[model samples]
Target: MSVIEEERVRGGVFKDINAEDEDQQPTVIESLCMTCYENGSTRLLLTKIPFFKEIIISSFTCPHCNWTNTEIQSAGRIQEQGVLYTLQVKTKEDMNREVVKSDSASTRIPQLDFEIPAFTQNGSLSTIEGLLDRAVAGLEQDQPIRKATDPVVAEKIEEFIQRLKKLKEVEKEFTLIIDDPSGNSFIENPFAPQKDMALTVAHYKRTPEHNAALGIEVEEEENDEKPGSDLDTMRNEVLVFNTNCPECNAPANTNMKLMILYVVNCEIWRSHRRAGNQNNLTDPSDMSRDLLKSETCSVLIPELEFELGMAALGGKFTTLEGLLKDIKDLIVSKNPFMCGDSSTADRAEKLELFGQKIDKIIAGEMDVHIILDDPAGNSYLQNVYAPDPDPEMKIEKYTRTFEQNEDLGLNDMKTEGYAEK
Candidate 1:
């Protein structure tokens, strides 16, 4: 071949290689900026993280108003079980640990009793100190507007922002918790291949509501039943169903007894609370019974004047002691505004006292009457004396009132539809 032809062939090969490299780089596409209502360019990069799954990172910038935003999304499917990570930040070095916080993950700081609710911020892959810096910047961004309109609120926020900055210094030990129902978030364990003493990981089964939030359709056993079935024959029958433990996702069988009365003449919804008699109220050590508190159940303690609504704790198939422990944890540790807001300081103090009383009840030190009122008639407190009625326990079943039906959203429901226009 001629020397000129050989040089042209070699140049063509290098040009093709350069084109392939350009294709692998981030793609800049036209996007509409929400801030400026102008056309912007978004650079999209699909890449895999080391020791993690694939992710897509997008950076949008608007030249009109200089608006910018960045977000990260997991390219993989949702995990089977949810995950919660608890890391104890005891040293300044811990602030440098890497973290992968998905958009669905909720973050909490136990020392400040502050929380960043899920979906409030975009997913981020950054160090602990970087997260804090982002939070501070976000808070400061709105300070000018707040100071102009409401100086009092802005002052409180400024003080809270300073405290958030101090957390990066690690002057005091604090617990950082990241809870993700999608099971995609992570915190770097400095000790790889071995367990890090400062980090604790827990896997939990996602609830039906959580599944719905993620746009997942979960198949329920109740949907298999026909429109009309034999109601009398199903009474007192122990219905066994499969479930996983919320904390560990271990397979378990939940046996539910048919205790409702659906008689032809009178429809009575059975809702029972095994209350302690005046004499037995002094001793609640043996009161640790299996409790199935449905989402519709409301718990009340008349003596303490404490009434916990149905939505406060959600559904749980745990023991009485376990339920009390959960209540304590929710109020004392997971309170979001416990430290920042001044108005809640008084309420926080009361909650701390209430937590102390709950501890006494758990330890069988307090005399309080616990009532589980379920308008839907789904809650159950196991009877220690199975076949016979216990002298210390009282059970009642009555028809629900109109107000109760309204609260349950049953009044708005039309079960027997015409299916006609």
Candidate 2:
């Protein structure tokens, strides 16, 4: 039988083979070594790992150059969701744990702030220690040349290499993260059947960008009319769509509404139609609401003359207080010049006052108007009184302007007759 055919047949048929039996070893095929241009022996072993899928392990040895190489390939189909493996390596035993790092997996050392990006290395079936050894080897390989040409750069690399070497001592705790969009990477669990306290495994749905990178073409669901029309029909019903949680890249669903508007007032006052509350916007403490501000949405505070545009704070699902705090952080905490010498007294004073006003709004100490103008109509504010109109809050829906539609990329969207294009 041909080597390929025999290999397949061997994989299908299970046999009780003893490790000590030399005669039962799989036959090695003679192959040409690309590097030495000499005949080498190549061995392919098809094996199933315990509690894991089947994998093909291949080894190549070229006697002419004394060159040896090993690699692994998964025989199983790709998983439906991407996986992220976080391992805390605190002890020597942790370094000995086996890891299956696929070519598409990115390895990150959080403490070191170092990352080995995906596709930079080939698939490896190695222990944590072995992985580090291979990395050191790679770094050392280019060092001599670097030392001769760029001594300073080489010196820096040598220092970094030393730091990586010290990690093998297990003197300090460190975290190793393996993120595989292909869902093929794995880090062995020492305590099988029982969960490892130091290890965290998360499965996430691949984003549209990830799908594109993986050469996946996603077809949009067929619709007869504009999506807005469908949403209008189902305005009363809560709409759920697939989305990944920002904090943890886990697969999650975002519940939203298309046209439901909430209008609220603290006092018993009847209101005619108003775009937003402009005067004495008192806190409706009873109306504690959850807010879902989509990335496409904009926040407007006319009192402060502040307009937070799209993509400022990515899609968030939080309490009104939490949302305000995030806004404060974005404007104050995250701004480098807010406190540093780079900021002038006048600028600093303005930001300080602005922050205090936001703080008051968050504390419910001040009465100020806040508006969420969502062009895509995905932003939501909770109505404590659902199934009935909120006496205090006003929810209004308006057609987006040409500029808003263009900004939201809706101008290029062909909701109807898209299949023809």
In TM-score terms, which candidate is top?
Answer: 2
Q: What is the lDDT of residue 70 in candidate 1?
A: 87
lDDT, candidates in the order shown: 0.71, 0.70
Q: Write the per-residue lDDT of candidate 1 for residues 14-62, one digit (tens) a residue.
A: 1211122544577799999998799999998765442234567789999
What is the lDDT, from 0 to 100, of the residue 296 in candidate 1? 70
Instruction: Evaluate model 1: give its TM-score.
Output: 0.48
lDDT for residue 420 in candidate 1, whole number 0-100: 47
**Number of backbone collisions per candidate, in order?**
0, 10
Which residue pairs collide in model 2, if any? 261-395, 262-394, 262-395, 263-392, 263-393, 263-394, 264-392, 264-393, 264-394, 265-392
- TM-score of candidate 2 versus the correct structure, residues matched by position: 0.50
List candidate 2 stretches off by more than 4 Å: 1-24, 50-52, 224-421
